[model samples]
Target chain A: MVPLLEFRNVAVDAAGSEPIEGVSFAIAAGENAVFFGVEGSGLKTVAPLVLGLEEPSGGDVLHRGGTIRGLDYLERLRYKNAIGYLHGDYGLISSLTVEQNISLRLEYYSEYLPEEITAITERLMAELRIIDKRTARPVQLTRSEIFRTAYARAVVHDPELLIIEFAFVDQSPLNIRSFMDVLKARGADPAKSVIFMTYEPQKFVDFADTFIMLYNGRIVFSGSRQDFFDSDNPYLVQYRSTSLRGPMAIS
Target chain B: MMDDERKTTPSGGSVAAYVGAPLLRVWRGTVDFAAYVVSIVLSFRSLRFIRLRSISATILTQTRFTGIDALPFVIVIAVLVGGVVIIQGMTNLPRFGIEGYFSNLMVIIIARELGPLVTALIVITRSGTAIATEIATQKWSREILALEIAGIDPRLYIVIPRIVAFSLSIFSLIIFFDTAAFLGGYLISLATLYMPVGAFFGNLSQAFSMKDLLATIVKSMMFGVLIPLISYYYGMMPRSKSEIPIYVSRAVSRTLFTIIVLNVLVSALLYFSWLE
Candidate 1:
C-alpha cells in the first residue's frame, strides 16, 4: 500500500542559517516513525510541513498519495479534518478548560449535539484518566495532566494520522511505551499510527519501528528500525553514542 | 574594537543617524499598523452559524470585562473629579469677581475635554496595557498559533471582540463619568450654597450644548478605536519577553498621541460646524 504521508526531497528555508535541503522520507500506513536528532536539529520545522501549515520551498508533499498543494477550500478543510496535531507544549488553549478543549474539536468539526459532545468528551477524558481535571485550564494543570489533556483532545477527534511534536522527549522509556500502548489500544488494527518528532530518540528506540534523522539541513538517515541502529553511518554513531547529549558548544 | 567602531561615525553622520533611525522606525511602524487594520477588515465575512455564535460570545465576554467591571473605578474617579472641579470653580474664579462664569467654565472643561480624556487615560493605563501584555503572553505561549492550527481565525475571535468592547466600553464609561461628575457637582452645590437644584442644573444645561455632546462623543469613540488597535498591534510585535515592555510602552504612547490628536480634530470640527 502507498504510504500514509510522504515528503519527496523537500526543501524548506524557514529557520536560521541551515535550511532543510533536499530531504525525503515516507511513513508507510500503520507504521510509527520517529524523526530524531540532537538540539537545533531542524526537525521541529519539518513537522509543520506535514500539516500543510508551512509550504516547502522546493519539492512536494503527497498526503494519502495525492498532492497537498493547490487544493480548494472544502478539500483543504477535509484534509485538515483528517489530521490530529499535538503540539510540543500540548497546544491547549489557555482560556478554555480541559473539557472545553476536547469537546471544542468535536462540536466545531462534527455536528454532534451539545449533550453528545459533552458525553463523548467526558468518556474520552475518563478513559485518559483526566476526568477530574476536566474543569481545569491549561495553566492550572500539572505537566502530566497537560499531556493527558492533549492526548484526550487529539484522540477524541479520531484522526487517521496522529502527529506528535516533541511532547515526550524527556519521558522515560516506560512512560513513552505507556503512551504507545494507549495509542495501540485506541486502534488495535494496524491502521492507527504516529509521526513523533524529538531530539531524544533513545526513549523511543524500542517504540519506533523506523528512524528518520535530520542533521545539517538534510535527512542524514531514513530507514527501518534496525537498519538505523545497525548502520555504521558516522552521523548515526555520533547521535547514538554521544556523551554530549546534555549540551555542547556549536560553532 | 568598540572604541574604533564608535570613532567611525563623524559628527554629521552621528546626527544624521540619530534622526534617520527614528524616522525610519516611525515610517515602518505606520506601514505595519496600516497593514494590520486592513487584515482586520478583510477578516470580516458574512456570518455563518458557528462563527456568528463565537464572535457574539467573545464580544459579550469582553464587554463584561471592559465595561461592567470598570464601573467602580469610573464612578470613583468621576466623583473625586466632580468635587475638585466644584471646589476650584467656587474658590478660584472669585479673584476676577466672575463667580457666575464658574458654571460655564466647568461645563466647557468637563463636558468637552476632561470627561473623554480622563476616561481614555484610564482605559489606556488599565485595559490598553493589559491587552498588550496579554497578547504578548499569548504570543510567548504560542496560543495564537494554536488557534490558527485549530482552524480558528484569531482576528475575528481575538481582535474584533476587543475592538468592539473597547469602543462600547469607552462610550459607556464616558457617559458614566459625565453623569456621575455632573450629579456629584450638583449635590455639592445643593449642600454648600443656597442655589436651587433647578437653578444649578439650568446653568449647567445652558453651558453644555449639543456641540459639546457631539465633540465628547466623537473623541470618546475615536479613543475607543485607537486603544485596542494600537494595543493589538504593539502586543503582537514583540519578538521576545525582553521586548514586551518596550512594545507596551510604545503602544501606550501611541494611544495617548492618537487620542490627543483625535480630540483636537473633533473639537475643531464641532466648532467649525457651529460657526457654519
Candidate 2:
C-alpha cells in the first residue's frame, strides 16, 4: 500500500543562514512515527510547512501523493478537514472557552449553529473525559488539562492523521503513563501515521512504530524502537537522556 | 514532494540593492488607500454589502478605538491652546490699539487650522499607534492566518472597524476641540480684558461662515482617513518580523508630519482662494 505521507530530501531555509537539510522519511496509514530531536533541529518546522502555513524554500510537501500546491485553498481545506495537527505549544485560542475552542474547528469547517455545536460539544466532552472543565478557558487550565483539551479539539472532526507534538509538564511517570493510556484509548494508534515530535524518547518510545532521530536539521537515524534503544550510539544516548521543558521554556 | 524542488532567492536582493522598495511601498500604500475608497463608493449596490462589514468595522473602531477614549486630552489641548492664542493676541494687539483683532484671529485661525491639526496629531499618537501595534502583533502571532484558515477575512474583522471608528471619532473630536477652544478664548477675553460675552460670540459668528464650518469638518474627516490609512498601510506593509516595529514608527511619525504640512497647505490654499 502507498504510504499516507512522504518527505523527499526536504531541505528548508526558514531563516536564511540556518538550512534544515537532507531529510527523507515516510509513514504508512495507521503507522505512528516520532521524530526525536533537540530544539531548533527543524522537527517543529515540518508540521507548519505541511499545514501550508509556511512556504518551503525548497522541496514540496506532498499530501496523498500530490504536491500541496496541486490543491486550491478550498480544496486544501477539504483535505485538512479530516487531519488533526496539535502544534507543540497546544496553539489554543486564549480568548475562547474550552467548549467553544473544541467546537471552533467544527464551527469553522461545518458552520454548525448553536444546537449542532452543542451536540458535538457534548460528544467530544464525553470522549475526551473533560466534560467538567468545558467552561474553562486555556489560561485557567493546568498543563495536563490544556493537553487534553487541545487533543480533543484536534480530533473533534475525526481526522485520519493526528500530528501531535508530545509534551509533558511536571507530571510523574504514573501521570504520564495514565495520560498516554487515555490518549491511546481515545484513538491514537501507535502503529499508524501519527507523526509525533518529541525531545524525550522514554516517555514515547513504546508508542512509536518507527523512530526517526533528527539532529542538527538532518535525519541521523531511522530504525525500530528496539534498534534505537539497544544501539550504543552516543548521539542516541545523548538524545534519550535530554528533557523537554516545553516551548515557553525556550528562549 | 517539496524536497527535490530546487529554490533560490533572486540575486542582489540586499536592502540597498532594493532601492525601489520605498517607491514600491508608497505605490502599494496608495493602491490600498484607493481600494478602500473604491470599496466605499461601490458599497451602494446589493452585491457590495460585504463592503459594509469593513465600513462597520471602521466606524466601530473609530468610535471605541479613537473617539471616546481621546476626549480628555483633546479638551485640555484645545482649551490651553485657545487661552494662549487669545492671551498673545490680546497683549500684542493692544500695543497697536487693535485689540478687536483677537476675536478675528481666534475665530478664523483656531477654528480653521489649529483645531483639526492638533486633534489629528493627538489621534495619530494615541489611537493610530494602538491600531498599528495591534495589527503588527496580529501579523507576528500567525493569528492572522488563524483567521484566514477559519474562513474569516482579517481586513473586515480587524481593519475596517478601526477606519470607520477613527473617522467618526476624529471628526467628533475636531468639533469638540474647536468648541472648547472658543470657550477658552472667551473666558480669557472676559475675565482679563473685560470683553463682553455677546461681543465675543457676535465677532465669532461674523468671522466664522457656514463655509468655514463645512470646510473644517471636511478637513478633519480627511485627516481621520489619512492618519489611520498611513498607520495601517505601513504597519501591514513589512513582511519580516524585525521590520514591523520600524514601519509602525515611520507610519506614525509620517502621519503626524503630514497632518501639520497638509494643514498648512490646505489653509494657505483656502485663504488665498477665498480671502483674495
Please tell me which predicted candidate would have the highest lDDT against the true structure: 1
Model 1 misplaced stretches (Cα beyond 4 Å): A1-3, A15-18, A65-78, A105-111, A170-180, A186-192, A205-208, A226-234, A242-251, B1-17, B46-50, B55-57, B90-105, B189-194, B205-217, B274-276
Once fitted onto the true fold, the runs of candidate 2 whose alpha carbons sit more than 4 angstroms away are A1-4, A13-31, A38-41, A70-84, A89-110, A114-162, A166-186, A189-193, A205-210, A215-251, B1-62, B86-107, B132-157, B184-188, B193-251, B262-276
Candidate 2 interface RMSD to the true structure: 6.4
Q: What lDDT would each prediction earn against the true structure?
A: 0.77, 0.70
Instruction: Report the lDDT tens digits of candidate 2 across residue range A18-133.
Output: 35777787777777777877777777777766666667676767766777766754677666764677654665666567897787656544655658778877877776567888
TM-score per candidate, chains pooled? 0.86, 0.67
How does residue B81 of candidate 1 score in lDDT? 90
User: Which tens-of-lDDT digit does each residue in B158-234 have in candidate 1?
Assistant: 77778778888988988899888888876765566555678777888888778777776677677877798888889
What CAPRI-style quality would you assign to candidate 1? acceptable
Residue B162 lDDT in model 2? 65
* Error in Å for residue B31 of model 1: 0.5
Encode model 1's per-residue lDDT on A29-112: one tens digit a residue.
Answer: 778888887666678777778778788889999888998998854577677767777876777778789998787656554667
Question: DockQ scores for all the models shown?
Answer: 0.30, 0.07
Each prediction's Cα RMSD? 4.3, 9.8
